[model samples]
Target: MSQVQTSRFNHKKYQSFQQSMPALKMENRQWPSNSITQAPQWCAVDLRDGNQALIEPMSVAQKQKMWNLMVKMGFKHIEVGFPSASQPDFDFVRWLIEENQIPEDVTIQVLTQARDELIERTYQSLAGAERAIVHVYNSTSPVQREKVFGLDKQGIIDIAVRGAKKVQDEAKKYPMTTWTFEYSPESFSSTETDFAIEVCNAVINVWQPSADNKTIINLPATVECAGPNVFADQVETFCKGVNQRENIIISIHTHNDRGCAVAAAEMAILAGADRIEGTLMGNGERTGNMDLITMAMNLYSQGIDPEIDLSIADEVVATVEECTQIKTHPRHPWFGELVYTAFSGSHQDAIKKCLSVQRDDQQWDVAYLPIDPRDLGRDYQSVIRVNSQSGKGGVAYIMETGFGINLPRWMQIELSRAVQEYSVRHSCEVDNETIYKIFQQQFVQANQNFEQQYQVLGYEVHKQGEQESIQASICDGSVHGETQTIHGQGKGVISALSDGLHKTLGIDFQVQHFDQIALSKGTNSQAMAFVQIKINNRKYMGVSEHQDIMTATINSVLAAINAYIDAVQ
Candidate 1:
């Protein structure tokens, strides 16, 4: 018996998110009425935000590979690095500019803290770019303001004001390059809604952004502390209170600390945010950023063009794994290798039926799959993988699709049980080839699966009117038992074979079922036969494939007789 153990830590020490974060002051929120109909302005932050979260950060080569991959995926704005903090980041930025690597259309962004020298260093890194966004941020949550910075509300606002002025002064030095300024009230979700608006407005006043020359006001859920609805309320309240709402691009940067980063980002978008900042595969600090891959796929599933190419999703995920030195979980959403694969019996059965009626000209309406996996370069062959948990429909689908052998209902039931036993015995999923092999060895009696007590050698059938006669040669298990022929007469070849088996073996069993199908569609097509017998009210089944229908029928009955004999012994 297991003992009841109490938890060691005290749960009373924790506070609810509402108690910790400041309340919103909106009289009537309008975000609930909104819905996401289109993709937002996307900014890839794999290098800046994602890199900082890595325990062993990407090497220069890895960073370059990741950068090139991001460009190819159609990201208009990519936060390349935190040039002000890391020397490697500074050098990489310089390399992009010096080597003419920045594309004419793409805008590379860099991040920095709201400090004097770091802000200046950030500008230095983007020296010769045609256009760039200099992102600056400072923590503004209640805990961060009081405990970390030991600053009052006004003092925190002053820090942001000074940073904004310095950023404006530095941008004047480079008149040739187009500049877009971005400021973040980091930890915005847990900060007072009115206070966050005030800081953003203060920064906007210094920059004086206009409709023609826009700037970004990023609000980061640096540590997600509430539900998506609460975050949406905070965003809506900020959008209403902030200055120059038209000029300021309300961007959301979310962390998955509470696993609601994407949910919050989606809600914030409905709350009037215009941009999203995230990393590929959601690789960032803690639980990582909202997975851009999942978000993009979500949009794609909804018939919205994500503006990013995911056709080579399998290849892209492999590259991300290689560069990050992290293996994607097989069950990870969308991009995982096995997310499109089904192992459960019900899931596989539904997927098979849906796929059979699916057409390229029509909308995707598969039962288990939301989107056609072929859209992402995945073949349908991997859709329904068979395992111990799989059922007849899955086995039948695999048999027909993989080997072109259509299994009848009764045969599918028997084959599925054989597959389950084999899978359990091997302690793994039974692959397509293995499923076929199992059928051949266990049912067809072709692979010497076990010491068969009755092995069919050959058979000849004679038909007159509706009556039939069969003479089958089989090796009955005994000391020096030679191949012997047994003769029986019945209404057809199948009944004659059953009659011969029961008379020879002295086991009275009724022929419960019989079936057959062509292995191919030509004159040289092989015949596959199946048989089911009931002895002592217990059913046994068998199968065989051969060029001659008579031979296949004979072997199939003999296989069933062998199964019954083995079970009785």
Candidate 2:
């Protein structure tokens, strides 16, 4: 036969499908009473649906890596791949059986169309696994029947019955591998509710699923309709109408075409779904599948153990994005960059005060943040940053984290104005480091009074032979314009400078530990140093930055003494 003739025959075969039968409509399309408090067991379809949608599908090695990560994340049942589709998929399934060390408790699932050859191949793929499930599905909606496939209602039913028999017969060969029969009334959301139940009941009978060999009726809101509650009502009605509730596990697969997939799945569980099939971050064909991570995390936040490990969710999202070439939006819930970050002034201030009061992050409300970023292996450095939107709280956070300089209430307000002005002018968000630099340039350096209180003109260090000592010459900027060039010797350059200041200005203070950190990337990155000084049991802080550590050290020490004097009087 010609290729055109072959294409025509295939088209006719699909078009022969019939319309779904309608049943008595309920008085009110409402969800079941029990749906208020329930969460379903999750089965991630990333390796199958997600991989199929990727521009460049993952290699076998990459697929193995993803599977291992998913298993680590406590996924007991993972739809690994569609085995009968291609050579690589077949090889990947065989690889899991031959080489991969799948856990004794975990079950690997494979998908295939409702055909005998594919069903046999699917069974071949499950060689030595302790637990394996065969997912058999065929389109049953009227649109699919009339437009896509020319099948009458009975034609679709015959296809389903034959498919279920083939799957059951093939699965019988593997008596050792516990078999699970799952059927999806493909496009169930759009099909007549009564017809969907009828088809599902037929499969349940053909499979002869006992309570032990439980069959799964995966009722997907394949194309989401109306609100989530409406879909919930449909699931509730269908579950109530199905013949064998004890012998079947009601599973939900919702697509996010209407952005209600997650809500629908949650409602479905309430309406009586025991299992869930979705993709991570909702990656799939159309608008994408429901996001399992979001739903699972939602349950976690509500104090319900969804029985999934989300500790590696950050890594999972990153790996999937690389393979799929789709970036997770920065505003995406739970994992977004700004999800835990707060740019608003009020939120920043509250978080700063909370951090000050309780060193433990768990105790803080962390307004606008649901969970601690550290819990997800993310840093809290970006939580509070500066912009026109920032406030005194943001400035204080910068002082505390970037420079060890703790500003008083009055000082914080004074600096917030300058930082906010700069942020607005630049039209950009600022980091703690930027706020620290601004604070230094204005409060520490711009004021001549502060500079005059104590200023070091120049200093040189010379090591003496007898002892490891250093000598430095320094000048002071006092009100009397007093420039006293004094020479002092001490163990270190900072010590020598402190000694020179004490002698010249009649000021005495003990130099505490000094710290320096690189401010940027490059060979010539500036080293920012903070000097802690204590005089008469009162602590003082000073910060400075320079290309040379020695220069920064000298400036930092003097700044500390100046701050102490200003604080005291």
Candidate 3:
């Protein structure tokens, strides 16, 4: 009673598990040597699996919206729903058939269990469908067979064969419509490859498919129980053993329980799968299905057309979010809000250099970015965000892209330090507007605190022969804040202004760098001037914006003078 020691803490209480799923026992497996050259026929299961997994299934209107979006994305085969399992699903299928919302080129696929009654009801829901696929499934894994259905190997085979027969019989009744049959030995990932081939072959024999009406043998990694390589082996084994290879479409439906659905789908394709069934953004049960968006973009990044139009990825994300009520994770591949953004200093610097170069072709060669964001309807402004970790290149990118101000190399370093200080003080990301404001406060408005000093009230410049004369009026606060007018002659307005300031207030500086550009376009467009001046071996920068170029230049020089005075004082 004082101290109880229990044997439950011993590791021997748990049984040892298999290190890996059994590898297919063939030395001549071709899948490992093959590469995916073309895209497989795509089938989106969002309406069925994706919808059923939702906490609140999509209403009829929402289903219609999703259906329209899929059609627009050019899906030839779409699994509308498991009509026999849900009333709304049945009604949605009937509505599509009756209202003729189903396009002639598109074929609607509906799912059903192995039971005869559910197969009959599934066909009823698709009675008037012009072209449809009847997908029937029965679990075949040893655990599902014994624990879920309490059936042996022969018993499971009977269920698949009977379901295939019933679907073929019902499809024959509709003489005017084109019908395709798909059979899934569900949970094929955990099933013995030999037994899975037997059940699928039995279903194919009952369906009696020809090349014109090929049967789809969908092998679902329904629970994703193994690594991608093991799943690929399972597919290779089934493809090798299945009879009538040309008359069957070997399809793969993968889940993401182990976060390997995309990898599994790609491996299955390499293993000779002819079709892929998945949903957008991987929305489904458990960890969700393989993300068709990721898979398609992966193909695109490799110079292969995924055969789906993803130019409007933002719209696709918006529609899916609205229908599913699930916000896309910010780090989701290709489609997330922040996938393309670079917060690291080195990454931003590399990206800035890449974007600055002009390419002769449409090749995307940017660093740290797999695809051009512009290709996906996103602009380059949001690619680099400023934080405490930001560097000169990232800050310069923001200024050039966001505010149209191309800061010089030296100014970039200067502004980056200010921005980093601001970010550290606030402990958050600095927005574009805040960055612009900081720039203005540092350069353009540097003289606000020294307003009582010498201020340029007005300035006029005139050129004569090779000489330019500038007459400037200033309020000199150092001289009891009195107003004084001074004149000087030089080669340009900037030169003349420097001479005038030196004569009026004994302030002398040499112009190091001067640049100007129109801030915008139009008759009323303003001009921006950037001036760097060296006073007593110390450098200072100033910026000014005004309607007149001469006035902006003068203001910039005066602001630089005040900044230099403030520093020395």
Q: Which candidate's TM-score is highest?
A: 3
Per-residue CA lDDT of model 3 for 248-322, tens digit only, reads 999999999999999999999999899999999999999999999999999989989899999988989999999
TM-score of 1: 0.88
Ranked candidates, highest lDDT first = 3, 1, 2
Every model's TM-score: 0.88, 0.75, 0.89
Q: How many residue pairs clash per model?
A: 0, 15, 0
Q: Write the per-residue lDDT of candidate 2 for residues 312-342, one digit (tens) a residue.
A: 6579778767666789988776776677777
Q: What is the TM-score of candidate 3?
A: 0.89
Give the alpha-carbon lDDT of every model.
0.87, 0.78, 0.88
Return model 1's CA RMSD, one decimal.
3.9
The digit string of per-residue lDDT tens for model 1 on 1-569 reads: 99999887988989888677646666778988987889999999998888988878889898888889988998999999999899999999998899998788899999989999999999999898899999988888889988999999999999999999998899999998899999999899889888999999999999999999999999999988789889999999889889999898999999998899988998999999999999999999889998888888988999999999989887788778877888899888888889889888889878888888888899889998999988899987888888889988889899999999988888888789989988898889999999988887777754234364566777678998898988878886643556778888899887777677668767787889988888987888899888888889998887777887767777777777777767766
- Model 2 regions lying over 4 Å from their true place: 1-39, 355-364, 448-569
Q: Which scores better on lDDT, 1 or 2? A: 1
lDDT of 1: 0.87
Task: Report how far residue 399 has shifted in candidate 3, in Å.
Answer: 2.5
Residue 154, model 2: lDDT of 90
Ranking by TM-score: 3, 1, 2
